[model samples]
Each structure stands twice: as structure tokens, then as C-alpha cells.
Target: MLQTDDLTRYCDDHRQEALEELEAWLRIPSISADGAYRADVRRAAEHAAARMLALGMQRADVLESKGHPVIYGEWLGAPGKPTALVYGHYDVQPVDPLDLWASPPFEPQVRDGHLFARGAVDDKGQVVMHWEAFAAHLRTRKSLPLNLKYVIEGEEEIGSPNFDDFVARHRDLLACDVVIISDTPVFSEDVPSLTIAVRGLVNWEVHVDGPMLGDQHSGLFGGAIDNPINALAHIVAKLKDEHGRITVPGFYDDVRELEPAERAEIAALPFDETAEAKRLGVPQLHGERGYTPLERMWWRPTLDCNGIWGGYQGEGSKTIIPA
Candidate 1:
């Protein structure tokens, strides 16, 4: 086994270079969710492939998927050892509400010893961590202890629509004994935690159309009909009850009940409810009534409206009904 001090020192030696390269990669606004940023997303994929090639990977390429590209790299120098695949995403979420940001979303900043950037935590940072680790290993020992393969994608921010098909087609290329993921965080900085489950995602886009032939005056049609925005609001509200239980039938049908030991383990976790609320800037805590905050966060299923769009959004209120 490698000494922890030796590994720590090796990482420290390359930390600055790692930060610089990560900041350069982060500068590309790879917002896969927005069609306008398609070129930027492609650039991010190219960057990942290039980084892998620089790290002395045997084969590295940005293969075309039905949607954005998939970056694949491999280093199989170690024989008679287990092979591992590392999966990550180079694409980042759209940085909206620009006004609220203290620094430009794509520009990297170092303040208070933390790297400030759009994809810093949610994943460019994690990808860079993997990059630096492998780079250091290669530089120090000139070879890895075990064979490694990488399959980083560029359409993760959006629902990875074509990734399943792409993976199925390349099953032989992606075959591995195990896969490592770096997107989610451990429980806390000091606490060593491994995520065991991934919640399934179901996205719905609801468009409520009312009698707004362009911009109708609210004054004339106010009481005559139900506004689309109002109707949507009601529909969204009915999805969940006052006690935070989902009103949709069969929503919890497939959820496996936590065992008594599992519940006990969760209950014993060190968590401060008030500190969590304050960290989120919420006045108080609220969620599914029966479960504790930690349980609700990690174990319970939930329904949430991610984005909602309705009428006039401008500097001041426009009195016209929006479509």
C-alpha cells in the first residue's frame, strides 16, 4: 500500500496546476440544457478528451452520441488486476439568475481558499480531482496499480436522453469490474460517507393555455375565466398535501421500506436541524412530516416543481395577461 504522506505530498505538489487546468476547463460555458451553448458544450467534451490524452491514456476520443459527445479514455497497463471505470460529466447546469452571482458564472475565482465557479462542486471540480489524482499517479510511479477506463458524458445536466443507447452499443468498450462516480458529495467534509442509492428522475413539462390571444387585458377578462397561471398554480399545489405527502396515487408504491437497522443508523447520524435550516437561508425546516430531515433528504421520495413559467416577467408588472 502507498503511504498516505507520500500520496498527500504528491497531490500537494500538483494542486496549483490542477486548479489552473480546472479553471481553464470551467471557463467554457458548457450548458447542455441550452441549445445556444451547443458549441461550448462540444468544447468541454474536447477538453476532457484532450486532458485524458495528456495523462498518457492508451486511447482517448470524444465519441458521438445521439445528443452531446461521450469522452472515453483507457489505460490498461496493469495485467492480472481488476479494471475500473470512472464515470463523470463535463456538462454543467445553466447558470440563470445572473444578477444574483457575485462573480461571472464561467470565470473562476479564488476567494477564502475556495474555488468559485458555476460547476465547481456539482462536477467540474470532481472531474478535475480525478484528473489530478491519475496525473499524479502516472507522474510519480510511471504506471498505475490497476487498469482504468473513463466514460465521461456531456449531456448529464439535461436528462442524458441518448446515453443509454450509446452505452448499450458500446458495451464491450465500457465493460469493467466496477465503476466509480464523483458527482455527489460525501455526507460532510470530516465524515466519510458513500452514496448507496440514486433516486430515479421523471421530468414533466406542463403547459396551461388560457384565453390569452397574445396579451389580453386582465381588466376586461379577469372574472370571466380562470387564468392559466392561476390554474397551473392550483394544479401544482394539489400534487402535494399540507402534511407534505404526495397526493398522486402510486407515487410511493415502489419505494422500499427502510429496515429497522437502517432507520436506526439514520437516526444516529450527526445532524443539526437548525443549522441546516440556517445554512439554506430558510426561516424554518419543513418536509415530509414523519421523517427526520436527514431521512427525508436521503431516503424519502419527493415531488418538486423545478421550473415554472407563466406571464409577464419584466422590471415592473405589466397589466396584460400572458400566454
Candidate 2:
């Protein structure tokens, strides 16, 4: 058996090579949101599976889904060790407004100690880190502390539409003692954190239609009929209160309160309210009046109007009430 020191040294020596491999992976334009890059996304999934197979995953393959594919790999040689399922996503967000990027989105670049690429921090970097860890263990004959199974999906940036179904269908295959994920960032450069919980989300789009007519003269019909735009604005305004608490019916009945110690620990965390406000380019911070910003973000449930539109938004103002 190889010693731990030998494994550590091996990891150190091959750090550059691992990083280069990550750069190559990042160079693939696997934007799942765009239909044009569907092939690129599949290529990325295959590339990831190939890398895992090379790193000693006995069984590694790309599983097809209704959308993009999911790459699965496992090394279960150790009989007594617990199993851990590692989850990550290879798909990336669409690089719209491409001009905003310093370099092309698919061209990896290192600048000022940071890797600049579309999927660098979003997931590819973190997923590659696991591969590096596995390689280090295998090269030095240092058996993994626990058996690991990798599942890399290609539709996370698009809200992981097919993941829940896949998980349900393959529950037996994916059974593990725990799930390991490295997608979230550390609390700070010096503070590493393990997220204990993730907030659930409910997304919706609202559409309001005015009268049957197309565009009516505001002067002639504005006072006689209800304006859909005005109604939508009113509905949005009623969603919150002066205390920043959501006003949705039954929204808070199920909300659990934080323990006193938990609140104290959160308060003690390194934070500057003024700095946070500045970072957000806001004059003041607002959220559930009693909780800190971090608390509101992580623990409290929120209702936000992601987008709203009903009437004309072109150049100058038109004198017509949209219908």
C-alpha cells in the first residue's frame, strides 16, 4: 500500500497537468440552453466520462435523458466502505452579449490568479477537482476513504428539468450513504463552509390581458376600462410589506424560527452591512427587518417578481392603451 505522504506528493506534482485538463474541458462550448450547441454538450459529457474511466472508474458511461445526457461513473471495489454520490453539472449558461467577455467564452484564460471562462467556477473547476483527488489516490495505491460514484448532468444551468425523474427512476443505482457536492463557493477566501441545506424554489410566469381591442386611444378609453399593466403593478406591490415580509397568504405559517444560538452564530459571522450594500450598488439593504442579509438569503423564503411586461416599451411613449 502507498503511504499518505506519497499520495500528497503525487497530487502536488500533477497539479499543473490536472489544471490543464480542466482548461481543455472548459474550452468546449457546451451551452445546453442553445439548440445549436447540443452536440457540443454531448461531447462534453462523453469527455467527462472518458476522464473518469481513465481514472479507474470501473464503469463509466453517458446516460441519455430527454434533454442533454448525464455522465455516470463509479469505483466500488472496496466492499466495506460507505458509498458517496458526487453530483455536478457540465452544462453552462449561454454566453449572451458575447462582447462583454474579455476573451471568447469557450477560450480558457488565466488572469490575475483567476481562471476566466464561462464554466470555470460555475462547475467545471470544482468537478475537475474531484478527478484530481481520485487520480492522486489511485496513482499512489491509496484506497479511497469511501467509495465514490460520479453523476455529472448537462442541464443544470437550465434548472435541471430531468434530474428529479432520473433520480427517481434510478434510485437503486444511485443509492448512497451521502451525496457530496462542491458547486457552492466557500464563505470567503479563508473560510470554507459546508452547506447544510438548500432552499427550494417555485417559479411562475403571470400573463394579464387587457380588453379585446389592439391599441385604443388613451384619451378615448383610458378612464372607462381597467388597465392590465396597472393591475399587474398593483398585484406586485401587494406581495410585500413595509417590514419586507412576504404578504402571500399562508406563506409564513410553515416557516420555522431559528434557534437563539443559531441566530447568535450567524450574527458573529464576518460581515459588513455597509460593504454588502455597496457591493449591490444600493443605498440601503432591505429584507425581513429582523434578520441579517445572510439569514434572509439562506433561511427565509422569498417571493420576487423575476420579470413583468404587458404594454409598449419601444422608443418614445405612444399615446395608446395596450389591449
Candidate 3:
């Protein structure tokens, strides 16, 4: 049996080594969204597989896919024990608007004890934690209590475009008693939160067309012709009311209400709206009127416009009605 105390001590003693490993992995800009970073993405996968193999995991390899490859590793020594599939991703979202960053996204930096990198939290860091935990167990106790399998994919940032098919093809290999996903947010820095469920999402690319055949002089056609940008603004503005409820007909008809037990559990969590607002650098918080902040975040549905543009977006504004 693995002694929890010993494992914790081993991890604490080798914290610097763990940080170094994570920093090395973070240096690779494995962005799945852009085709230009394909080689870098593969490099990241190879790096993960190498770590898994070094840590005594069996069959550690970068398995190919139509898109970015998936890294697989397993330690199935404990017979008749529950198999836990540890899922995470090596690929990170594109670092656009790079000018806003204090340091380079790929160059991992430790600032005030916090690691700053592209994949620091939103998954690579968590992936490293799993590997390091396994390392600690193997180094100290020589074996794990239960079977373990790793499925670190490289296309997760791209909405996991290739994950479903990869799983379908390798059903037996990926089978497990329970899957553990570390790619989630904790409630806060001090609180360790386990999120059982997440809200679903739907995306649509809405386009608005103007009456003009092409761009026209806004000064001349401002009042005569309707501007697509103006029309789009109106449409987006009407998506939600002042109370933060969606204006769409029958939008909340299928939404499930929180049970009494669930509400109680949520209420038990420590939260301060004022502190959170201050931490977020906002004067106040806003959400659906009826639900608390936690309830609104965890259960309620929300609609947001991610990107919108219909006019000139350069240094100087072009005085034209976009078509």
C-alpha cells in the first residue's frame, strides 16, 4: 500500500525538479489552432511520452491521429483494481494579442511564486502534477495501488476536433473504470474544488448583411441606408435583458433547476462577492438576477458574443458603411 504521508514528502522534497520539468515542457509552443505550430505540437507530445516512459509507465508513445497526435501511457500492475484514466492535453490555445503579455508566452517564468506560461494552469501544469505524483509513488513505494492509464491528447485546444474519433478507434485501449480529468478550475487559490459537472455549449457564427453591394461613404448613406454594424449591435444588445436573462423564446424551458441538496452544497462553499469583485478588478458583479454568483456560474446558461466586427479596424477609421 502507498503511504500518503511518504508520497507527499517525496513530492515536497523534489518540488524544484517538478518545476524544472514543467518549465521544459512549457517552453514548447504547442499550439494546435495554428497549422504553423504542427511540429512544435508533435514535439510536446514526444516530450510527454518521454516523461511517462522515464517514470516507469508502460507503452508510452505518441499515437498518431488525423490532427495532432495523442500520448498514451499505462501502469496496469494492480490486478482486480479499479483503472483510472487520467486525461489531459499538451496543446495550448494560441497566444494572440501577444503585446499584452508581460513575458513571452512560451518562456516559463516564476513571478511571486506563481508560474506564468501559456499552459500553466489550463492544462499542462495539471498534467505535470499527475506525472510527478506517479513518479513520487514509483520512487518511494515502487508501485501504485490501482491501475493507471494516461490519455494526453494534443488537439484539445482546438475543441478536441480529433478526440472523439481517436477514442472510437481505440475503445479497448482507452477503457477504464473511471476517467479523471484535471483540466478544470479550482474555486480559488486557497480552496481545492472538485467540479462534478459542467454546462453544455453551442456555437453559431452569425452574419449580418447590409443593403449595399459594397462599402459606401458613411456620410452620404448614413441615414438613407441601414448599416450592418448598427443592425448587429442591436441584435447582440437584445440577446439578454437588463436582468441578465436571455430574451430568446423558450431558452430556459429545458434548463434544469438546482435541487435542494445541490443548492445547500453550493451555499456551504465560502464565497465573498465583494472580495471576488475586487480581485477581478471590477467595481461590482453581474449575473442572472435570481441566482447567486456560484449558482449562475455552475448551473445557469449564458450567451456571449466572442467576436464581432463589421467595419474598418485599423489605426484610422475608414469613413465607409461596411457591407
For this target, which candidate reaches the highest TM-score against the unseen true structure?
Answer: 1
Give per-residue lDDT, candidate 2, residue 322: 79
lDDT of each: 0.87, 0.88, 0.91
Report lDDT (Cα) of residue 220, candidate 1.
85
Residue-level lDDT tens digits of model 2 in 1-323:
74579878898898788888999899999998999999999999988888888877889999988889999999887889999999999999999888899998888988998899999998999999888888888778757778889889999988899999888878888999999998886777887678888777778888877878687888889889888898899999999998999988899999999999888878878988899899989998898898889899878999999779877898988877777
Candidate 2 residue 258 C-alpha distance from true site, Å: 0.6
Candidate order (TM-score): 1, 3, 2
Model 1 Cα shift for residue 183 (angstroms): 0.6
Over 3-71, each residue of candidate 1 has an lDDT whose tens digit, in order, gives 667668888887787788899999999999999999999999898789888878888899999999999
Candidate 1 weakest ten by summed lDDT: 1-10
Candidate 3 per-residue lDDT, tens place, 24-103, comes to: 99999999989999999999999989988988887798998889999999999899999999999999998989998999
All-Cα superposition RMSD per candidate: 1.6, 2.5, 1.8
Q: 2 or 3, which is superior by lDDT? A: 3
Stretches of candidate 1 off by over 4 Å are 212-215, 321-323
